[model samples]
Target chain A: MTEFIPPGTRFHPLPSPFPMKRGGALVGAHVAFETWGELNAARDNAVLIVTGLSPDAHAAANEGNPEAGWWEPMLGPGKPIDTDRWFVVCVNSLGSCKGSTGPASMNPSTGALYRLDFPDLSVEDGADAAASVVRGLGITRLACLIGNSMGGMTALSLLQRHPGIAHAHINISGAPRALPFSIAIRSLQREAIRLDPNWNHGQYDEVTYPESGMRMARKLGVITYRSALEWDGRFGRVRLESDRPDEEPFGLEFQVESYLEGHARRFVRRFDPNCYLYLSRSMDWFDLGPDGLRQIHVDKVLAIGVHTDILFPLQQQQEIADGLREGGADATFLPLESPQGHDAFLVDIARFGPAVAGFLATL
Target chain B: MTEFIPPGTRFHPLPSPFPMKRGGALVGAHVAFETWGELNAARDNAVLIVTGLSPDAHAAANEGNPEAGWWEPMLGPGKPIDTDRWFVVCVNSLGSCKGSTGPASMNPSTGALYRLDFPDLSVEDGADAAASVVRGLGITRLACLIGNSMGGMTALSLLQRHPGIAHAHINISGAPRALPFSIAIRSLQREAIRLDPNWNHGQYDEVTYPESGMRMARKLGVITYRSALEWDGRFGRVRLESDRPDEEPFGLEFQVESYLEGHARRFVRRFDPNCYLYLSRSMDWFDLGPDGLRQIHVDKVLAIGVHTDILFPLQQQQEIADGLREGGADATFLPLESPQGHDAFLVDIARFGPAVAGFLATL
Candidate 1:
C-alpha cells in the first residue's frame, strides 16, 4: 500500500515499498503534483488532470510559478476546466524525468541513479500513484478526470483498476490498445536513440547524452503528432530563413523542415532519453479492452476523437464509447472535425474548449 | 548533350562534359540501362521505363540475366508492357548508386569517388540522360513511357524538356512538385543519416556505413509508403517471434516492428546512404509546374493515383491530368482503390495490370 503526504509545491514520497505492475518494485517512489484553487471542506470539487507522454505537473500557472501551463488555454479562471469552480491537481507521471521518480532518480538502496535499473512501469502504476497523491491530499473523490493521449489511457486504467475514484472521466485521442502502425512508429523512435553511438546503451552521462538521436526522434514524433493536411495548409512548400537570398540549393530549403529541426533541437534540452523510452514502451503495452468497461464505476464518460488523428484514430475513441455504452454506462462520443489530428486536444483549443466546458458544466 | 554508346548490359556514357540544370557539369557521367526484346526496323516500338528511388535498370528478365524484374507481374512477353510487341528499356536514374553515375561513381576529374562533390542532380538531368539513351538506341519514337513515384516525375520532365520522344506517357503516384509534407519527411530521413557518428560526413568506408540510421530512415519510409489501414489489416497486434519469446515486456513486441527491421536490414546491403541523400534531394528539386506542360509534345497521358496515398494523393494526379488536358494533350485521370496507398502501383498488380494493358492496347 502507498501513502502520500504533501507539503509545499514540490513532490511527496509515497509509502515505502511500492509494487510495480510487471515484475519488480520501487522502494522510495515519490510523485510531484501541482494544485489550483482551494479544496472545499466537503472535498467533492477537486479535479484530477493526467498528462501525455511529455508534459509534467505544470498544468496551469499559480502563485509558485507564474509561467503559464502546457494546458493554459483550458485551465484558467473561466476556461473549460475552470479553476474558479474546481480544485485542480495535476501529477507529473511516474517514470518521467520531470521531478518524478524515474530513471534519473536515485535508488534508495544503491544510492545511484536508477537509469535502466528502474523498474518497468505501466499506466496502472501511474494511476495508482496519482490516486495515492489524491488520498494524501485528503480528497476521497474527484469531481472529474481529464486526460489526453497517453493520459487518456491512464485515466481509463485508473477507473478500471480502482473504481469510484472519479465521478466522470474525459478521454481524448487515446486507444484501448496500441495499434500496429503506432507500435511501428514508436519502435523506430527507440531505434533512433539506441543506435546513437554516444548513447552507450542508455548509460550516457550528462556531457555525452544522445542529443542527435533524441532530436531526430523528436522530429519524427512531431511529424506523426500532426496531420499532413495541417502541414499542407501551414508550411506548403515555403522556404525558411531565406532573406539572405544566396542560400545553398541543397539543404533545409522548406519552412517545414526548419520548423521540425528547430522544435526538436529545443526539445532535446528539456526531455530525458531514458524517460522517453520507458514512457513510450508503457503506452504501447497498455491494453484495457481485455478487462472490459463493464466493471468501470464512473458516473459519466466523455470520449473525444479528432477525425484527422492517425495515431489514435477516431475509430479507437468510438470503440471506447461503444464498449462503455454496451456495458450499461452513460457514455457520450464527441467526434471533432479539426486539422490538428492527434495533437488536436493541444492545438485546436477553440474546438476542444466548449465541448469540455459544456460537459463539465452538466456535472 | 549526352551520347550513349552501349557495349554491355550495364551502363552507357553520357556525352562528355554534361551540363546540369542549376549550374556545374559532369566530365564523364554515364547512365545504367537494360533492354528487353528486339528493336523493330522502324525502331518506333521502343518503350522507356522510368523507376522510383532505389530501383535499377532491371525491369524484366532478358538474355543477359534471366532473373524476374521488380515489376515482373506487369512485364513479360504478353504483359501490360509486352516484350513481344514493344522493346522496353529501363534506366537506372542519375545520382543513383545502382551502376549509374552517382555520388558513389568515380569522378574522372579527380580519379576519386564523387561523394559530396557530385554535381547537383535533378529530374531534368535524369530525363536528359534517358532521352540520350533512347536516341543512342536509334529509337526515334517511343510507343509508350511508363513511370511510377519518382519515376513519374522523371517521365514528365522528359516530356517537358524534350517533347515528341515518347508518343504516350503514363505517370503513377507522382507529383508535379514536392509538397511540404513529403519534403519534411525526406528532410528528417537525411538528418537521420547525417547525424549518425559512423557517417563521417558521408566519407565513411564500406566497413563503417551508417546502417543503423539508414535502417531507421527506411522504417520511416515504409510507414509512409503504405497506409495505417493496411497495417491494421495485415500485422494487427501480433507479437514478434513469440515462440518461447522471453521478450522483455518493452521493446519491439509487434510483428510489424520485426518486418520493418528485416526489410531495412536487407535494403542497407543493396543501397548506398550517399545515393539516398542525392536522389532524395533530386526529387525535392524537381518542379515541372513552373515550366508549364504547354511545351509537352506527348500524344496521350494516363495518370493513376491511389486514394489512400498520403505522399502523393489523388488530387495531385488530377492536377496533372488537368494541366496536360489544358495544354492540348489527351489526358485521362484514373483513381484506384487500394489500401497499398503510394505503393499500390507496385503491389496492387490486379488493378494496375488491366488499366495499363488497356491503355497500351489503345496506343
Candidate 2:
C-alpha cells in the first residue's frame, strides 16, 4: 500500500527507465516519488498532487525555500491535504527537473543529454510516467487527485489514461482544453527563446540559456496571469533609481516593469530552458474536447477557480466542469473570490483549505 | 480690424517669434481658419476651436476632401462651434505638421533641420502660442474656447497662463494633469523610437528616418487610444494576409495590428517624431493646482468625457471639473456614450456632434 511522508520529510528513489511515451526511440523516464501517511484498509486513502510548470518531488515544505511546492500550507500533518490521515503522493512529471526523466537525462541512443533531440513531449508522457510512479509506490487507488494550473492539466490527463486509479478530482484554475490565446502566448515565448543568439540552437554550454527570451516570456506571461486591476494596484507608475544610473539611459521608471523583468531573469537562472519549453508544449496540447477528455471517465469532480485570474481563469474552469458533465461525470463548479489573480489558488490557502476539507469530508 | 474669412476656410499667419512668459520660449506656429456667417461690427464676434491632437484647419465639414478635420460635424456654420454667430477660428498648434513649424521645419537659428534640436515644448507654450496667434488676428477676447484631449489641456493651460481670454471653456475628455500611468505608457513609445538604431539619437533626416520605430510608436499609441473590447469587436484575432503569402518574417500580423502599424509608419513620415515626444510630455506636465485649486481661477466650463477612454478618462474629467468648481468656476460634467474609447470624440462624430452643439448653444 502507498505511504504518506509528512512535511520536512524525505524519500528514496524508485528508479527505472520508465519507458517514456515519446516512441521509446528517443525518450524514456526515470520516475521517483514520496508518500505521506499509511494507506487505509481499502487502500483508497491516497491523494496525488500535480504541481505548477516547474514544481518537483520535494513538494514537501522545505524551510526557507519560497519556491517550494506552491501548496506547502495545505500538505502538512493535519492540513487540508492532511498527511496525518491520507497517504499522499507527489511525482515530478516527465521532462522536468528533480527525479523524473527529462531533457537533461542521458539518451541511451546517443549516451548524451537529450537536449534538442528530446522528442516532442506530450501531457500523456507525463501522465504515463506519473501513473508508473503511483503504481510503483503500491498506490492502487486515490481518494482524490488535486491539480492546480499545469498540475491540474496532468490530473485531468490521468483520468483518461488510467480509469480506476483516482476516485475523484479537484482541478483549480485550469481548463479541460487549451485556448487559442494560450497557444499564441506560448508561441511568443517559444519564439523569444528560439530567437536568442546565445541559445546556439539549444547547444549552449554556458549558463545564459536565453535569459532575455525567458524575460520576455515571463513579462508577457505575467500580464496574462494577472488582472488589470491587480497590475494597477501592484505597480502603477511609481519610480525608483535605475540600476545603471550612471549610464545614458539613466532615469526613473515604473516599478511594475522592474518587478516583471526581475521575475523573468530569476526564472532563467534556476530553471532549465528546455524544461520550460517541453512543459509549456504539454500545456498547449492539453485539450480534453477532441480526444483526451472524451476518453476519460471520472466518478466525480470539483473544478474551482478565482475571479481575478485572466490566465487559466474561472471561465476556463467552468468549461472543464461542463466538459466533464458532458462526459457523463458528476461535476461541480466552485468560483472563489480573491485578488491574487491566477496565483490566487496557491496564495489563498486559508480559503482553499476549507474547500478541500469540505470535499474530503464528503468522502 | 481682423476681416472675417468665409465658412469653408482661410489661411492666416500669426506674428513670428511671438511673445513668451518668463522662462518660456516660443515654438513656431502659423494660423489657418474657416469661418461661418459674418463678423460683428465691433470685430468681437469670434469663438475659437481648439482642435484635438490630430486635426487640421477644416474643422466642420468633409466638403471636397473625403477626410475633413476630425471634428467635422461638430464644427460648422450651424453646429455647436457655430461659425455663423461667432467668427469661429481654428489654428494648427505649434510643433505640429499640417503647415505648422515642427522638427521637419528648418531651424531659423541654425539654418538647418532642427530635428532633435527643436526646443522642448510644453502645454504653456502651445497655449501661449495660440493666444499670440489670436491676439495677432486682432481678437482681444474669445467668445468661447472649445477643446478635446490636448486641446482640452490647452484650454486649461490658457486659463492658468492668460486668464484674460474670454471665460467660456469646453474641455472634452481631458485632464489638468497627466496621470502617472499615462506617463509610463507614453514613455514606452518614446523609448521605442529613441532606442531604434536608425533613429541615430533623433538626428535622422526625413528621407532616412526610423520607420520601424515610428510604426512601433503608433502601434503602442493605438492601444492607449482604444479599448480591448473594441479590438475584439473589430478584429477578433483576424490576420491580415498580404498578396505575398508566406512572406519573410511573418509579415503583417493581425489586421488591426497592421492597420495601426501602417498608420504609425505613415504618421512618422508626415509628422515629426520630435514633436510627438514634445507633445506627449506637454500633456504629462499639465497641472493647474501646483499651488492649490483656488489659486488658479477658471470660470464657465463644460467638461465632456467618454466612458471608454483610459487615457484622459472621464474620471480625470470629473477631477478637472471638481478642481474648476473649487476654484470658483461654473463646471458641468457630461459622459458621452461611445465605443470609440479615447478617440471617441474623433470617431463617433454623430453622437459627439449633438452634445457639442447643445453645449456650445449654452456657451
Candidate 3:
C-alpha cells in the first residue's frame, strides 16, 4: 500500500544512516511536517506540535494546504494555539504513513517496501526524528513543545534526550509508560489485524487489504476513544431505522453499531495497516521509568487529561505533573471533566483549547 | 460440533411445539438442569438458579455429577446458596450449547444441526424454558431466584412473564436491557465470528473450525470482563519471560497479552461459536425498557454489581434495583468495590458470596 500523505506536506531530509533507538538505522529518510505562521527574528517564538498515532502533519490550513486538518479547531490563526502569536509546526511521527517514512515507505537501500523488514520503531525514535526536523528548521530552542496522545510520549522522550530543547512543555492525554490494560487493548487490535487472512503477513495489496481486520481494530479504538457516558447519551438503545432482514443475521441493528461501521469503514482505507501495527507496538514498548522525567530541563510543564479517558486515565496526567514538578519544573496538572475520553483532546476543543492556550500564554 | 454437556445433566422435555418468543417453535425440545439437595414435601423450600450464556446446568457437584460447576464456590451444601437448607435447581439457558438445545443441537424434524437455521432466540425464550423446567419439577413457586450475568436478563424476563414464579430475586451483574456500549461490543464480537471464512454461514465443523474468529471474539470478551484497574494491579507492564521472536511481529510480548491468548485458546473450541453468536445477539435484543420491571411480581429483589464492571456496569444494577423498588418490591442495590469488573461475581466470591448468602437467608 502507498503512503497516505496529505497534500502540501513538507519534508526535512534526515542525515544519512540515522540511527534508530532499537539497534538499526534508516538511510535516505525524511520526516514530514507542516508549519503555520512565521518564526520571530530570534526564532524564539517557534512552537512544535507533535501528534498522536493517525494524524498527519497538516494540523491546520496554511498558505500551502487549504484543507482543514485534524486539530484545526485548536491550531489556526485565531484559535487556541494562535498561529498569529506562536509559529506552530506539527510533524508527523517517523513511523507513520502520513507523508512520513514508515513500514509502508519504500526502502532506499533495497528499493522495496519496508513492511515487516522495517526496524523496530520506538517512541524515542519518533522523538529523535522530530528533533532532527526542529534542528533542520534552524530553531535552536523552541518556545514550547506540545504533545497530544502518542506525541505526548514522544515529547517526554525529546525533552529527556535533548535537554532544554524547549522552554516549556504540554503533555496531553499521554502516560509515562504503557499500562497493562492499554497494552492488552492494543494487543487484541493487532491480533485482529494479523488474524485476517487478507493481511497475509503485511503483503496485502489494495485488492486484499484486510478491511475486516482494520474495521474491527478501528471499531475497538473508537469504542475506547469515547466515554460510555457519551455513548449512552448519544445512542442509548436506539435501533437503526432500517434494520437488516432476519436472513442476514449479525447485520447492523443498533445506532451504535452503525456508527462504528461508518467510522471504521472511513478509517480502514485511509490509514496504512502496517504503519498502525508499528506505531501501536511502539507505544506498548515505551516506558520512561519512575525518574525519567527528572532528566527533562524545561522551565515549565503542563499535563492535561480528562476524567472520562479510560485508556489514559486522569492519574497518568497527575503522574506527569508530579514527575515534572519533582524535576524542579513549574508544573501544573489540569484534569478536565470532558466526557469524550482519550480523544477529548481532539474533539473537546472547547475544553482542551483554553487549557492549552492558557498554558502557552503563561509560557 | 457436538454439545459440550458435562456428565449427569438431567433433561426436562418441554411441551411438544415449544414456542419461542420471537417466532418459531421447537418440537421435541428439552431444557437441561441439575439438582442439589432434596425438596421438602411442601416444595416451598425449592430455589432455582438461571445462568449466564456459557455456564451449564451443573452449577455445582451433586450426587449425579461429581464435577464442580461454574458457581461451585457460591453454591452447594452449606455454601452461599446453601443446598443443605434449600433444594437448588440450576438450568442451562435454552440457547446455550452446554447440555441444552441450542444452535449446536440436532433439529428433531430436520435431523441436522440447527446452526444459523435456529430461530431467533430471545432472553424471554430462555425464561420460558427455565419456567418450564421449574413447573415440570412440580414447584409452584421458587423461594428465591438467582441470576448471574446474562442470567439476570433471563430472570427479569421470567419474573415479568411468569409472575410470582419466584418470591425473591438476586440479580448479580445483570441489566434490565442491553446498553449501547454493551451492544456495540457484542456486535463486534458477532461480526468477528461472521467474518471468518471458515464460519461459512455457520457451517463450521470440528475439522474446519473458525478458531481464529472465535479466538478474537473470546479475547475481546475477556478484555471487557475484567477492569482496567485489576489489569494494572495484576499484570502491570509485566513482560513475558520468553517473548516471541522478532520474525513474528505481532506475537505476544506482555503478560496481559499472554493471559488473553491462553484464555481465548481454551475457550474457542469448548463452546459453539454459532451458539455464542446467537446468545450474544439475544442480549443485544434484550431491553426490558423503562416500565418492564413493573410487570414483575417478586416479593423482594437484590441487584448486586461491582463498581468497575464495564460490560454490565454498576448503573445497570442500580437501575434494576430502582425499577424493582418502583414496582413495589422490597429491593436493595448493593454495589461492591471489586476491581475485577464484570467477572467479579465469578472470581471475587469473597464479596459476592456473603451478599448472596445474606439475601437468601432473609428469603
Maximum-lDDT candidate: 3
Candidate 1 stretches with Cα past 4 Å from truth are A1-9, A242-251, A294-297, B1-8, B242-251, B290-297
| Model 2 alpha-carbon drift over 4 Å, by segment | A1-26, A29-60, A63-217, A220-238, A241-250, A254-261, A264-363, B1-106, B111-158, B162-184, B205-217, B231-314, B321-358
TM-score (chain A only) for the predictions, listed in order: 0.95, 0.87, 0.98
* Chain B TM-score by candidate, in order shown: 0.95, 0.86, 0.98
Which candidate would rank higher by DockQ, 1 or 2? 1
- DockQ of the two-chain complex in candidate 2: 0.12
Q: DockQ each candidate and list the results.
A: 0.63, 0.12, 0.83
> Which run of 10 residues does model 3 chain B get worst, by summed lDDT?
B241-250
User: Could you tell me how far off, in angstroms, the CA of residue B246 lies in candidate 2 after the best superposition?
Assistant: 4.9
- Candidate whose DockQ is highest: 3
State the C-alpha lDDT per candidate: 0.83, 0.66, 0.90
* Model 3 Cα lDDT, one tens digit per residue, B29-129: 89889999989999999989888878888888888889878889988888998988999999989988988788999987899999988999999999999
- Which pairs, if any, clash in model 3? none
Candidate 1 vs candidate 2, lDDT winner: 1
Supply the TM-score for candidate 1.
Answer: 0.94
Which lDDT value does model 2 have at B134?
74
Q: Please compute and give the TM-score of the first chain of candidate 1 against the native first chain.
A: 0.95
List ranges where model 3 is wrong by over 4 Å: A1-3, A245-247, B1-3, B243-247
Estimate, for each residue in A1-363, the C-alpha lDDT of model 1 and write its tens digit: 011112234787887788999978889789889988888889999999889998888877887777777888999788899888999999989988887798777888899888788988798889888889989999888999888899988988888887789988898997888888888888888888887777776788779989888988898889889988898889877776663242533457778888897899888867888888899888878888665666677888899999988889899999888777776668999999999889999879999999999999989
